[model samples]
Target: MTDQPAVPTDDPTVLTDRDLEVLAEQLGREPRGVVGIAARCVCGRPLVVRTAPRLPDGTPFPTTYYLTHPGAVAAASRLEAQGVMREMTERLGEDEELAAAYRRAHEHYLARRAELGQVEEIDGISAGGMPTRVKCIHVLMGHALAAGSGVNPLGDEALALVRDQWRPDRCSC
Candidate 1:
């Protein structure tokens, strides 16, 4: 039989700004920034290109801007689910579903964090505690996504209690 072209299974080529914007929309948040892209070969492994800062050698790093692929998203979602599970195990303890959701969200946050690195604090406090450098981006992005998804991580009563104590209007004044 004639040799059929090898089927590609990589993540996909680098994505354009527009592509990133679309992914952001799917995520219900603004695209942070373009870091790099990756392509998955037919074997389904990532061929990554490092974007943004260049390597010392000055050769453009492989694939940074990855084309959006269903497999990639699915893989990300799975990792996120795992992270959520880890958090729940630590915080809530033994929650299968909540932990799963948290893990899923966590995976997404970790990926984004890898790309964005640490962001400046937003001048606020979360129920967990004051923001710290290590997990600042995770907390902020989690809050944003939770708010956007209408899934309040903090119950209404807890929020109200916090609000009463730290009223923005009064606190600033």
Candidate 2:
């Protein structure tokens, strides 16, 4: 809704039954509120899912793009354990340019979620602690993949760090 540049969503891609099954297998449960495959690997497996703002159970789900790939999730969890989030949060405090870019990322995320459906309960709240601090690399990486490049600086950085471990070109699927 704001003046931020639009991030390309899954308007061109369609999710198949196989994709759903794979996602469900990865999650170990039925995928909920999933609208479409936001990002995929080179092997064409679903990496990120574009979910509804509110779940079917009437619960507000602010995580618009969710990372579902097992390998990527593990890498992000490893990064979290290594205190990458803490370092990123500290950097955000000292870096004006990074903070401004992160704010735009939050706005872009909100606009994308609004396109799906806005939930009043989770209004203006983007996942993984955007526009402020780094809470979850998995969420940020999901947004970075969904939004493509440059929309989220921190997310981009996190993705770059994990590139050797999980590259989009190299199929972990």
TM-score of each: 0.27, 0.92
Off by over 4 Å in 2: 1-9
Q: How far in Å is the alpha carbon of 134 misplaced in model 1?
A: 13
Give per-residue CA lDDT, model 1, range 1-173, as digits (tens).
22222122212244566556555654455433335433222332222222332234543322123323333334334434545423423553445554455444444433433443332331122222211111222232223322333232322122233333322122111
lDDT of 2 by residue, 1-173 (tens): 12232233586348788989999998999999899988877567788899999999999999999999898898888899999999999999999998999999999999999999869999989999887999999999899888899999988898889877876656666
**Total clashing pairs in model 2:** 0
lDDT of each: 0.32, 0.86
Q: Report the lDDT of model 2 for residue 30.
A: 94
Q: Pick the candidate with the highest lDDT.
A: 2
Looking at candidate 2, what is the lDDT of residue 162? Answer: 87
